[model samples]
Target: MFGSFITMLTGIRILKNINKSLLGIIKYEKPIDKGIEIAGYDYDSVQDIFYSNMNAWQRNMGYSRLYDEASAPFGMIVDCEPIYFKYNNRIWLIELWKGQYDLNTGCEVGVYTAEKPILNLPEVYKYMFYNCASDEDRLTISLSLKKNGKTLFALDDKHWWLAGFKLGEYSEPSELVMYLNITLKDEEMCSSFVEAIKKIGYEENKEFIVNGNTVGLTFDKPHTTQPITRTEQTDKIIQMKNKLLCDKYNDITRVYSNLTDKINAIQKQAPEIYSEIVDKAVLRKYLRSMKNTETE
Candidate 1:
């Protein structure tokens, strides 16, 4: 009972969210002919700076649960190699480049994080079906990841409306197992989306597996062509829509301001003309005088 309690406290826990800003790539070494170097602890002066930044994160968050595992993949950051680091037990990919790499004048580094947590993989899977407009979606009650890094999504036998998730064919060896929900409106749209993925260098069945409902993809390392996330796309569309609305409102305000300024100028410079046009009583008198003058 004591061991069980301890496990509950230390075992895998779902993260509420990941702060990308907390994970930044710092350049510690200049590029040489071979490659740039990620500052190792042995490099005392530079290591201080690296740890100084890392300390900020450590002070803010708790230690990672998977920090000590032999297969955890965290190591000294190095150039030209993709390092898999565990940040709070969530896998992240950090890649460093040498100056020899095209389009880069100096050493550069990049850090990529999973869009969703591993604990949330099942939920992400269900969301995919919902995004697909599938009549149903679900995971089995006994959902578990296999030693071979695979899992199944099954629906209720009696209740078709309940939800259904299925495991499709897979090809790559992946440390991370997850599903991508691509819910395009129609076949043409789906084809375009698939093409977009392919254009970024993903192959069908080898790098990704597709089925009637779910699209299964794995992330052993950072992917060149990432799965299209529905939430991100929606957020982008909303942002763009907001920007356009704001622009339109500003344009309308500017035109209204220009007209208001012209009216005020007339009122100041030509009070009679302004009153004749604007004031009801003055305009009525002006009209009556004009009529009498025309009659004479």
Candidate 2:
């Protein structure tokens, strides 16, 4: 019975993982590099020269962190900046690389002109990225998760720079992006898509109806502020108990002062629910605070 319950929990987590991946880009056997003036040069020779340098780096243990998951195996290449430098002779090389991948695959995609992850991730509940451990620059990750606005789990660990996620079968073409999979729990992860949704600039406290062309949506909100967290629920019940006890004692903790004493006073009092509730509340509060700081 115990093992079965654990297995079911594991399966539920896997379902979430599978569903989230549906939002990422997918391709294979394709180096995402494009638009370079290896100009007037044979493609074969350029590829060979690239490999020669790559082989030397591999021999020097430079790519040792190739399989690192902290290395954002998936992300989007958002920029391409040009640069020129001179050593023995005048030479031009793209100095910035900017791309995105599934942080677990260690693949570089998008349009990186030789740049890497420039932002820190304090809350990584829903994404993976390049994490590195180098004698020089280090890779680090600090992110948290909040599902349905409730803290779930967290960690603050240093990782090496990463590249991409492992290639899986493509479900759709590049045109139909899986809409940035953000769970109700991922309050922050869906920001990009959310902004896109807002860009339509058509809020309808009243409907903006188009006779035969425009679409429709309503923006009436139907919820209250600060919905009860699990801890809040637990806190409410405890507050009730404390108030009842205080009133009975004419304002003294004396009523439950011997609560633990009573626990031992009885043969088996089912392990005082009040103590269990309070302990849980305290631990959860601490953990939630930690997770919140991780993103900040």
Candidate 3:
């Protein structure tokens, strides 16, 4: 009976050590990224700069969260200050946040319209998307936006004129929403974007809302298109030729000499055909055969 009691004590001690080790990990080993750091600014300076320049709504929201002393048990809560930059002669604001349980951070970017009209709306849209996206996300976002030669507008560039967008977070959808600024002028760019949104199957008052030049748009139901494939034989030939040139060969000069001889042989074999035509045909056939064999 005493031996059994000692065994129970030893098991309890083992569990206690394990529990202590887990607690240490939970306290110190969080997966959060290093906190935000802006160039040429300390922590206190960053806070002061953001607070002084923020709009009333932004000030209220930031301070309310900043001063909150609520306990967070799941993940560490951080109060990050907004950062500013100048693009297209306008001051742009970027606000970052990491919630108590959030594994990844979220950000909202905004910029007031320039006094003068923007010459290129598509360029601005591309810049905004890229600025907010991470390095890994840039290519994906670019391909999605540029798919099928479509911009923010379904219509061609000639048809659209003025366009602006605002980015912010929404609670109900729990995602970033783009609020488009539409103008009533003849060259207004907003109507086309709205029409494009409709074409993609978004509904008014359901997926989006418009309030006097500001259209709050949600992208819950995204439109998918078949991935673009290179179907041109010429393009494929060029790619194969490039690959062949880049490939490691024991004698690159000898390979080129062989290719030239093959071209000459094709010219000799098809004397009736134009010299240019014979040369191109031989090169294309050789590259195509090489590509096929490589695939095999």
Candidate 4:
């Protein structure tokens, strides 16, 4: 019976590993460069290059403030100054439009001069998430799960720099917004997504009406009006210490229970060879210690 129980637990552990492998793989890849740094490019030169290479589509229709000009596809919308930069002598422009993507009225797009191929879709995302911190400089990193059950890395068409400074009543600090579409197919992906967000201390606001399958998210840097204190650190240390103690206690309890069952069986068969090494006093002592720790 003991051997069978061990085999069952081992099988369960294997199944969990298999499940994790079946889910989509997420990779964080870094950028490449020569001796020169590409990130700290001059702003005016980048903007001028981007303006010189604008396609007729963007030039004729793309106004600076479409929302305020009363030509916005969406209702009154927030605005942020477009970002431009040059990397490896290539000019790039990032524009946020009131109606950029097909589904969402607002979207952000990064354009380049196309003299040489710029970073692919995935590389663009890695640069945003791993390299950049400014809202104006980063793209929304999202996971797309379509109705057909295909999962892929997705980016929001609209990127708002600080969600457009002082737009309406949103007075929060600078932050980034990401969107996930058609998320119903995979439970593991959704669970991991939420846990990953929590691990980074990002708050989720669910007031947008994107659709049942779609999820909109934003993450801001942690803030506190109060000054930092030693008491806060002490509290965190205490909480972690208690958690470690509790985990150890639970593991010990499980082993003790299994051993006790075996001891009882052996005692019934041959009391001379097998006897109770543990008594009520020992158990009581352990329980009292745990209680004392909790009180402390």
Encode model 4's per-residue lDDT on 17-88: one tens digit a residue.
Answer: 434422322121211110001211111221111111112212222222111222111112222223233334
The residue-by-residue lDDT of candidate 3 on 1-296, one tens digit each, is 44334334443443454444334333422201011111011112211111111222121111111111110111112222232333344323222222211111122222222222254343332122212222221110100111122222111111111111111110111232233322222223335445655654668998766665445544332342211221245334443432332222212222433433433443345332222222222221121111111112
Number of backbone-clashing residue pairs for each candidate, in the order shown: 4, 51, 0, 5
RMSD list, candidates in order: 30.1, 24.7, 29.1, 27.5
Per-residue lDDT, model 1, residue 279, is 29
Q: Work out how many backbone clashes candidate 2 has.
A: 51
Worst 10 residues of 1 by lDDT: 69-78
Q: Where does model 2 exceed 4 Å of error?
A: 1-125, 128-271, 289-296
lDDT of 4: 0.26
Q: After superposition, how far is residue 264 of candidate 2 from its true place, in Å?
A: 16
Error of 3 at 182 (Å): 9.0
Candidate 1's C-alpha runs over 4 A off are 1-174, 179-181, 210-214, 225-296
Error of 4 at 259 (Å): 65
Best by TM-score: 3
C-alpha RMSD of candidate 2: 24.7
Give a tens-digit lDDT track for model 2, residues 67-156.
111111112111211122221221211111121211110111110011222342222211222111232322123322222333222223
